[model samples]
Target: MPGIDECLLEVMRLPGARGAAVVDWTSGLALGTIGESPNGDHEATAAETAEVARMAAEQPVFAGDAAVAGPGTRTPGAVPPHPPGLPGLAVEDVIITTAPGYHILRFVETSFDSSVFLHLWLDRAEGNLALARMRLGDIAERLVLA
Candidate 1:
């Protein structure tokens, strides 16, 4: 089990890894980040990745299209009825395409109440998608962010 900093270092050890960030899906915030990219801002990149997770969690289809019980539906621990399946939502990982690279976001289930995720940026030209996915899965299991 490794901490956030060590996890980022391990991700960088993967071949072709450019940059990495740990984001909180619920709040669209970066918990930690490593490396750098020539493509402008890292915080913004992390923020967008968090947004992606938030959007996925909010999709009606994923929640079985049941009408949410309230005006403003909230995620877990927000004083509203729990979003169906969210307590058990199992996202292995997510991959998105960029103009110059591929973004891999791996959700990590931690001991804490909030969900955390790892965001990795890789150069498409140099990255192996399949291998990256496998490695991210392994890393997620090994993560012990207490």
Candidate 2:
């Protein structure tokens, strides 16, 4: 698996990639960052993105039937709650499209708390939304935090 720096380098290789960061959603901290931030401050960007991630992960709507039925309740055909150590929901990524750019928040599943996610900023004109999403998923899986 690649470490934080190497993984970020790989992410920046994507076309139209303006900035990238590995963030800890629980604390709104950037573990690593590269390229240029949307707001000219990577830390602030990380904190803002983390808020989005945290909200999405914690919402019961994203948790499916399991969340509505209560933690341990199960219906005959309902999807199960997320596995322990995973997010409360099974959200893989969140995408935000603007007039000029795209923001992608790809959640990272770790052996521990699973609170980290990879954030990518891509120029809408030059970025391939489909390709970036797929590549980000691969990068998130191989990212290793120290």
State each model's CA lDDT, in order: 0.74, 0.88
TM-score list, all predictions: 0.75, 0.86
Candidate 2 to truth, TM: 0.86
lDDT of 1 at 73: 54
lDDT of 1 by residue, 31-55 (tens): 8889984356777877788888777
The top-ranked prediction according to lDDT is 2
* Residue pairs of candidate 2 with colliding backbone atoms: none
The Cα RMSD in angstroms, rounded to one decimal, for candidate 2 relative to the true structure is: 4.2
Scored by TM-score, the top model is: 2
In candidate 1, how many Å is residue 127 off? 0.9
Local error of candidate 1 at 85, Å?
14
Query: Candidate 1: where is the Cα deviation over 4 Å?
Result: 63-87
